[model samples]
Target chain A: MPTAVTPSVLTRPDDEPTAAALIAAAVETMAVHGYHGTSVRDVAAAAGTSPAVLYHHFESKQRLLVTLLDRGLDVLIAATEEALDLAGDDPAERLGAVVGAHVGVHLESQRESLIGQSEIRSLEPAGRALVVTKRDVQQRTFERVVRDGVRRTVFTTATPDDTARFVSAACTSVAGWYRPGGPLDGPTVIARYRAIALDAVGYRP
Target chain B: MPTAVTPSVLTRPDDEPTAAALIAAAVETMAVHGYHGTSVRDVAAAAGTSPAVLYHHFESKQRLLVTLLDRGLDVLIAATEEALDLAGDDPAERLGAVVGAHVGVHLESQRESLIGQSEIRSLEPAGRALVVTKRDVQQRTFERVVRDGVRRTVFTTATPDDTARFVSAACTSVAGWYRPGGPLDGPTVIARYRAIALDAVGYRP
Candidate 1:
């Protein structure tokens, strides 16, 4: 079950490159095919490598799965942080910009988000808990944005946390149904999603 | 792979006694182990039954999984319908009710919802297509509600489809990290989600 954790430049400092590739591959395959339907070979095939390559990169099939969860969350956090940077001096504009950025990143990494969401349970309990904790941080970040808006009296909301969650969920689920060549591209989706988020939470520009 | 399709029931159709028990058991096992990770034997073991009984009831594992989806959708639809049944014909009231119901069902059946949301790929191509189509229908239903709300001037500004999706994803993801005996129970979660939906969409009561 022991597999290598080979580090790569494309991955986070602690992440192995092969492990990250395996994860990126797993994200594509697992989202398209359920985790159960996918095999170690599928991850290898997608990476233009073999199962030994995957093992050489990670600790075990389970650990590789866990690594993906960890990295996906990391990517999501990084993405969310970037989105938050879009926040401006004005609360509503900041909210809209932030939400747009959030949705933008979601569609940008559609495969990764979809797989992380759908296959989270494939990880061991510890991994599952870690993912949940990271997700909470993401949720809290949204809540903070909404709370700031409310305090400014620019956006009127009864429950900021609930509103934050609505924005979060709507933005995340775009990965599931959005087609690459559809009438709505990622930009359009982000724009529309931002409108929805701002209006839902009553952020007046 | 042969499985029985228990369509009619003497009891309330929503609570399919044996099927509920089976799906409930399957949801827990499937979410963790995954559709591939879980076997009928595992489901039966979790449910305190024999695999023979499961096969006799469901015919095949895939069939059972589909049944779970069918049940979860039924509950979700019913909740939405119930929410739509607001008095005084106020679109805002109806919208809030609908949001509440949507979140309620999602939070209540978090496990089953998660299973259906994640394991959808395990279905045959045709089955998966059917599920996608059904999901679209659900989306359209919410869109119509948003449209009505907008027409009634209950909302400040938003596209119906995007707003509908915003509401939908908000509640749907409650299953992802919602722990039993967590700080927020079903009612609180539903109410909070409802508030979020209302604010996001600009529902004025």
Candidate 2:
């Protein structure tokens, strides 16, 4: 498989802007123009900073992406776990909360969520493996939800694995066409998605 | 919106293979390597022909894409319409049949469907409009299903439009990951999707 290789070097010191800002800028630019279509210079320009400052923090573009993907996946995994935890031992209520949290992750962390899912392959081999690991972790967590739901007899999907993959694909692809101009706003879209997801997973909302 | 222009010629005059074969080859190549990544040489090679033969059929790579977009949209619209017509006046049953037919379209013509949805923007002005028209038609037909469902007290969502959009996005993106690999065959996937979609749209299946 063809993979990008990472390089590490920076002449600047530790007073640079936070990695968060750089990753945010990279997210917007990468989302609009795609990963390859954007450059380090464009990211700097969009961030309203110099390449020297950017280099001081990230070392390279792929490193910046790695930072973003890690942060986003961290947020995603935590939110799903939190939702499941908060719902207690009840399968039906727990199922709805998990769906809400899944949709909420996309809405709250739209940019990071999108870039992590779609643009991670643009990262170098090491960075890509890191992102994939995080993704697999989340997928397994989702699988656990399905297994739990089935065990509790609250959700009875025809095929647990296929249902899980279908729901994950829909949830992840939200950032592709989602924007401010849509007919539904954040909470409304989340509610709608939660309802549909719950139903598809065989929960009665 | 940069778009590929329509070719001056509809098809070819002394072509033994026919325009349909040429369109299929172009779509296959485009799906494998997005619009910008594919070349006329790659498409011609796939078709078991030469560049001169391609030029006779398509004015340029852009024009060839436009033709494929036009043809893909036509096929989907025709298939869905035929499915609708076959279902008669029962909304829930009609919608189930529609879902089955929708999956059939994906299984039978996944390559064109994939390219048309993911790479249609590569088509020129007129060609883009043609694709959009067909898509809008599909969307409208879906809306009709939702409307009928709501009118008959079948669906409970506040907005049919968002529900339709979410369901459409969910099923269509299946093209990205769905393989001919079957622990679930075409009929099984279609059957599951029909049940899933009907419940999703508020049908009590």
Candidate 3:
């Protein structure tokens, strides 16, 4: 139940360098060294700035991590929402879209996805709650699709909730091992995942 | 790829304290602080022993992690093999058994499973290769069942290899979120995963 008791603060607008650049620097440092292994000084050094500059833009090291995680989740949720829209009304197609979108986004932003998934332990209570809440919202989109499919007899699973969980787990794992120029391209991988997701739900045709 | 260039060494057998106790200590420490964040001193403290005692059992910190990971994978492979044996001839049944045993074993040894999955990056080349070979062997078990099911038309998947990967990913993720005394018990969760596995391959029965 530990929470980051500090209120969210805006990055300094008048800084010499943009906050976006600072955030990008933090992401790279964290991605390579892990959250606990990296420090504000390390990030600033990697970013070609000083601790004073970093502190000017962000309240603390904890805040930098929370911001990065929140931004990553935001990007993921937005992309998946768009995919759901394009999927239209068919539950099977919708689920496939969800899988493809999930895999594609994770692979596209592999580092952020890796940090977001792995570093939940590093967050304080409030930051953790915020991230979890956002994650739950993303999970609900998949759950709703599964529930719809089951209700309509279009798809069948013994446990709908766990079904959704498994699908999320499977898709998210692409980030762990997938290489951009490997045997499978983004579309090829997405197609394969779509097949797997559809097959897992007992979808026919 | 960065490989741990050092060759694997045999663990010391004649150490003052048993290797098992030191391993238990290492697993607990790595589980909390992560591989990079932990040191020999930290593990010794957790194990209630001195660094000299730890060094007697494990050659170095890297060696300690590699040993722990190897042991974890060995235990996992053994348990899954037992599950496969109980599953007998039916491909659907075999697949179900794989998922059930996977989730069950992961939940039972959550910490080791977590560390095993996450810290492969920390291993040296020889150690990394050793671990990857063992992991591939474990992966092949699932692949064989899926391929068998597809050949028999008892289960259908467009890409059997990808299907196996997805299933492995999904089942391993149970260790991430499952709580021991949560609403669902071990068997209940396993049964649910069994259904998902069966459905993923389009198993009719």
DockQ of each: 0.64, 0.31, 0.61
For model 1, residues B1-205, the per-residue Cα lDDT tens digits are: 1133223211244654665566667766776677887989998877667899889878899887777677677677766776676534777676767777776776666666787787787787766776677776677777887788888887765577677777787778887757879787777776677667777677766
Native contact share for candidate 1: 0.91
Candidates 1 and 3 compared by lDDT, better number: 3
Off by over 4 Å in 2: A1-25, A36-72, A108-133, B1-25, B39-60, B120-130, B155-158
> Can you write out model 2's per-residue Cα lDDT over A1-205, one digit (the tens) per residue?
0012111111113424444446657777765554655678887777767788789878987787777777787777888889888887766666567667777778766655655655554577898788788888877776777778877677777676666766766676676557866766877777777777776777742
- Say which prediction, candidate 1 or candidate 2, comes out ahead on lDDT: 1
The global Cα lDDT (0 to 1) of model 1 is: 0.71
Q: Judged by TM-score relative to the true structure, which candidate is superior, 1 or 2?
A: 1
Model 3 agreement with the true structure over A81-174: per-residue lDDT tens digits: 9999888898988898788888988988787888887788779999999999999988998888888898889886757788999999999999
lDDT, candidate 3, B109-132, per-residue tens: 888888887778678889999999
Candidate 3 chain A, run of 10 with poorest lDDT: A1-10
Best of the candidates, DockQ: 1
Model 3 docking category: medium
Candidate 3: the clashing residue pairs are A2-A125, A3-A125, A3-A126, A200-B200, B4-B124, B4-B125
TM-score of each: 0.85, 0.75, 0.89
Instruction: Note each model's CA RMSD in angstroms.
Output: 5.2, 7.2, 6.9
Give the TM-score (vs. native) of candidate 3.
Answer: 0.89
Model 2 scores a C-alpha lDDT of 0.68
Off by over 4 Å in 1: A1-21, B1-21
